[model samples]
Target: MSQELKTKAHLIYINGEWSGADLDELEVVNPANGQVIGCVPNAGEVEAHEAIEAAHQAFQTWSQTTAYERAGYLKKFHALILEHQEELAQIMTKEMGKPINESRGEVASAASFLEWYAEEGKRVYGETIPTHTQNKRLQVWKKPVGVVAAITPWNFPAAMLTRKMGPALAAGCTIVIKPSGDSPLTAIKMVELSEQAGFPKGVINLVTGSSSKIGKAIMENDKVRKVTFTGSTEVGKMLIQQSAHQVKRLSLELGGHAPVIILNDANIDAAVEGVVASAFRNAGQTCVCANRIYVQSGVHEEFVDKFTKAVNLLKVGNGAEETVTVGPLINQASVQKVRHHVEDALAKGATLLTGGVSLENDGGNFYAPTVLSDVTASMVVMHEETFGPVAPIQKVETIEEAIALANDTPYGLAAYVFTESVSQGTRLIEQLQYGIVGWNDGVPSATQAPFGGMKESGFGREGGHEGIESYLESQYVSMGIN
Candidate 1:
């Protein structure tokens, strides 16, 4: 029994209080050791409504407050996030089974969003639309869209919450967040800090529960003026349909089967490291995780050898351990899904270059970091989002073939290109069909860039100035002097 396996508290935050209802409770398990670490209260319909109503009421006052005042409180909240980051990181590691290094990075990343948006609160700019006549002026202003319902996923709990909450709070919108039940503890703590920062009552609320019941409640509620969701494409589509009758504003960051291409002229060592980091970080559960690797024919053998060796050397264990390189998948279901994908690929004649099975002795949801070569386009592992620590490598003769294979999937969330030639990188950037592209690098997003997807990957943006626009309603105002 390690410190990471110790039990902890799990309570919902609504209107600045830690309260639990009579609803069903679910155990928050440490995937690293199969230990029950905490119990989260599942939000029933009544409790969900309570959170919505609280947000609705708080919006009345929060929306009317001066931008400077809101910014002040947010700034304080940002400082508090820094003060308590270590504790929050420990909670994230125990609850979600992400490595301590990664967990700490996530906490810091989460805090950065709060700090960035606090400053951005003062910069939500509106403009005077130039009028046709000198005596008349058209003024356009941005206002909060009232109560917001934000549903985030489990992959990056802390960072995802901050990304959605940052813009909503900056725009003066009160929020009722339904974090993924699998990793709800860290989010609960964050809401507590927001309350301590002097935010108005009900301005930020947390509701945890089964996805179907809580998701439908938020989607059907008229009080929730806007919805921001980060999850699977299938669920995102359903949410859009549910919100159709009310025509609620939506921002969805959905599923991704991102592609990474390595040209013959690129640096093989750096490219191998980039692929491994981008693919296996967080156990390859990230929506933006690289699932497809296309290496040019000239360097295909060398790249595969280096990649396989690197992956095989990774250490998998408890997330709280300082030496662990890879942690367990979030749950048993994720483990099974990854297993199925790899098995299917093997059945389809994909060669297992390094690893292909789960580790039995770990007593956790631990799958070995896997690499497969000789993968064809028809293999399931090549097309589907294998949200696990598995990378499938394919050989390509030309850049055109690489781009075509990359864009063949129904998902177009993100893609990466590695090439030494500036001309080749530029060409690939133009040809790749994904929404966000990394040239000669593996970086997926920045707080300053717009992040979203195309095709079946869902719609809307999550960062940059464009993110705030999603929470605003545009009304054209006309004035004339008589």
Candidate 2:
């Protein structure tokens, strides 16, 4: 490891106290340099159980609070996030190798979730069921699901934590958050903010550690009423199996091999720009990032030329620099994974249209934004989620062929289509198998919309009113009067 001074503390929060576990301390490295930037307590089964117990205790009172009362606390929390957005962004950049600009955006996105859900807390509605003209009436009620365990990935730490926690808190559910060990500093600081915002003790807890131990503890805990996770499909499958035994409610936002389709009549310039931003932002670490692109045969060659040029021009450097467009992969393992995918694709006969090599920069986990053309369906990069700055482009004869190729992958979290014809765009949108479809743009999600996936990408929705419902359980009551 490079000799960089670590600035973050190493501790885990349980039962409203910062404590050390018997597990080893995990050093947080900056992916841009492979330098130590912080350390977090690598919690084991013991700490995980403690967090669950804390959340369970907090839920006794938290879940009993009025929706209006919960809304007040969330509003304060939202304002506190805004007050420290810059500090949180810097922590995120140091912990995860995201460009400072993108980190700032992540901070803003986190705050938006809190603000949106704060208002939603007061609006959770229950309906009275209509019955036949008799002396009987039926009422329905929605109540918090007690304790929740939120497992988030390192790709977008701040936003992922808030996206899950905001709705859970708004719905009067106490939570235990287990952030990825790779990037836990920002989340730990956010937990500090929760205390400062005057949230009840034990209402929100943070635990960091190895995935296997922490995940098993959360899934096996009978006190945890629900489990929410965002990560790879393989891990998601294991969590689902574990949750099955306990019959716990689960919300999994798993791996995605998103597709981008460029039509013959589309605006090439606009589509190319969208592809560059969508596929390479945060160095293409996002789950919804477009990994597969199918260009209509009529404009495939031209699109490839422009897309390659754009990838070649990206500025790869430290995330702190304002001019840097692409930052390093989150870790050496991630770099190796990207390299493996690229090398496998080339070995399988795909042609490298632009970049296909790692950078010579010292210490940084940097890989050049790469573009591969003449890619076939058989290549690993075509079917798998390459969580890095690698784009695999393929050509299709028509829109029907493009859609067919897009849907060929088992993962269907998100899809992108660029076209000028409104009628054609609507038709394509209706046929796409993805949960979220972007039309003529690369934006996959907004706070006002629902986001999740179909197929193996996992289930349950987040954002908007639907997000709040995930933390609640419904009960119907019927009464008769003689």
Candidate 3:
């Protein structure tokens, strides 16, 4: 099954067909062992434009599709995802270095997004407006925004693309997607599923290339009414600048440096579990993963010891191996970035309790899951998005101090608070500027909830009913009474 998946992973899917570009081809390497896995077409401006044109042309008919019909196609897609679960998981693990189990879970999560949106599509209802005129009635209707160009990141490649594409298609919008160059195979394979589910030609397209060239192509195309991107804050800012030239509808899910607070009265075990899961999952490559952990002074000593022990227990190795919990960083550059952050924290007088060094002879871009104590806001790890498995704990004297430290960063993506008191929880909920807040848990949002950011993290929601609404426009119709 893995060999079969590899055969189809090399090509790009454009306008219901698989093909290579006349331009360069990107070498897709497995980060775990540094092996060349496959080569996908390094699409250029021409190919990107081709995809936009195809989606634009198809939107006319696809937008005219009834909600019921679109739901049917989405249901088929959901089933197809499960059918290709193993292969999809392997492709993601090989390409991005996330553990196989994690990748499999991601595929299932991606399918759930499709399933949720399929039913949610039926509920894209608009309200009727009351007017002053006695002889007329005003009714509002939801209409699909035209072509959408979706750009997704590498971490959790399958889920990210599906989360964006699921709702876009459910809202009757045709779309073209540009997956991350490091992990295009998952997106390309998803396109195959979309085709097998009998989507009309041109309704779905995939392009791979220099993100700048492809993003420019997406921005400049007038037919593309909406743009949805999930990646770094730097790139998100760049897209915002580019979108200024043409006022296209936009949804940007960018970087995050989320904070998790451990109050004095919080259950030690539960808080420890949340901290470990959020800090080390996907080797901390996730955007919403916990950044700085603020532990109340009363329990700081015990919390640090527990966290240090947990970090040391994690096994770092190839993602394909079932025993691996913490996998290699995506590539050499990512490893260097993690190393730099750890070194900076240590140099700034933070104490490394466990796992700061990269694996010396691991035969992979592997960095150990690290834990640091006495982390201050002045440290580089606290200020920037480490995007690595390094949990830095900061001791705070009070809830006020914790909130102040948590909200200090420009990012407002997701935050976590562990508390036993209702008053403390209420304060955390109201005071935290993050878009999504988790209480006693690490992850706060899911397929059934609207997830986004409040400040520099980015804009627009991407799940539940609100998810599809981003891809649709409201139209008003008036009828005169005879």
Candidate 4:
């Protein structure tokens, strides 16, 4: 397996030009091997304002452009992603430690967001309402909401970026994006492609680093009409509080401690496989990764046996290797966080069904795919968003108990239910507080459906018809004929 990663020059994409920051360069490390794969500008307050001003300036004309015109740029952008799919995938894998093939698959799936929104832009239709008076008519129009700030996380770098940008651009809103420091290369490349795709100057801008400072500027900037963010629950709350004064339109995709319920009627084999896929994919660094598995007591033993074996069979190594199903965590902090969850679970009387240790000796931020049985609601793993390759299995005697346990967390992002009976699946779906529900199969995330969470998990949807709506505000007009 090759270890060398490309150098995406440390520059900010502002106003259709690659601009240098006044601040120093932040080294982009390859999480798999701790090598400096590249560097990106640690954009300071000045650069942040520049990007915001640029987006604000461009929004005047960009927002007036026809949906067809905006979609054309997005279509070209989607094509450009595919044109350099392999290159983008390589950069993503190196920067974030997701397996190589997973990175490629992400890039491919990511293109769909652009394509979906490009076409969906045409369907941003308004409605006409009938009034009691024949002479009166009521009509509504959806108008683009000026400059948008897209603050994204590193996990699923390409997909998350596109999901935010695709809808924003399609809605004729100019965007200023701030990608995670650990994985800016893919975001940078995507923006670079956007430039080549014929987007007008400042239609899209990317400013890297200075999370707090840049975020503060974004919140304070009156020109920034809307904001979309994907990160921790705490950070999302902070952004909310900061932007409160501005009353900006905000869309947040925050933390999730998603649950997977395995009922007695479920296919143990299929349920186990889905659990592994949900909990371990992307080295378990996902907002919606299944954090807790509730198994019916009737099949608990058999399910644990099969699930443990499946997890153990996964190869753990650098993502560059095809056989390595689990790669390193984004960095050492992820290693520590995952370890903290495992240790906390064990302290609370959880029994390790399979692996529960880190591979620190292997020289990267790697942790074994872990499964913990005998877990209970009192354990930290039960309530917290364990954003790593750790799965805690708790046994429940009744569907009611399973549902209660699943809804116990503060988050309500995504949930999974495995059952042979359709009614049972629908019941769980209706009862679950989560925004997205998967029955018998995990949601692989296509662009056609809405994706988001209810309650504290986050506000606003990121995909589907509703995705673009967040970037626009409605205006109602009631007219009198004659």
lDDT of 1 by residue, 1-482 (tens): 24432323367777877788566788787888888777788776778889999999999998988878878887888888889888888899988889999999898888887777777778877778989997787987778899999998888889999999988998899999999888988888888788778888899999898788887789888999999999999998898889899999888888999999999999999898888888989989888888989999999999999998899888988888998889999988888999999999899989998878898745789899999899899888888898999999999999999989999989989898888999989988888888888776676578867889988888888788787778776666778876
* TM-score, cand. 4: 0.97
Q: Please, what are the lDDT tens digits per residue for candidate 3 over residues 127-243?
A: 889977999999998899889999999997999999998999999999999999888888888888888899999999998878878888888888888999999899999888888
lDDT of 4 by residue, 276-393 (tens): 8889999898888989999999999999999999988998889988888889999888889889999999998999977788886347888888999999888888888778899899
Q: lDDT score, residue 458, model 2?
A: 92
Q: Which ten residues in a row have the lowest lDDT in candidate 3?
A: 1-10
List, residue by residue over 1-482, the lDDT tens digit for candidate 2.
Answer: 45433333467888778887456788888887777876778788988898898899889999889878888888888889889998888888887889999999999899899989988888888889999859998988889988999999898898899899999999999999989888888888888888888888889988888888988898888999999999999999988889889899999999999999999999999999999989999999999999999999899988999989888899999898888889998877888999999999999889988778788665888999999988999899998899999999998998888888888878989999999999989998888999989888887688878989999999999998899898998889788988
Candidates, ranked, lDDT: 4, 3, 2, 1
- For all predicted structures, in order, the TM-scores are 0.97, 0.97, 0.98, 0.97
Q: After superposition, how far is residue 469 of candidate 3 from its true place, in Å?
A: 0.8
Error of 2 at 418 (Å): 0.4
- Among all candidates shown, the one with the greatest TM-score: 3
In order, the Cα lDDT scores of the candidates are 0.86, 0.88, 0.89, 0.89
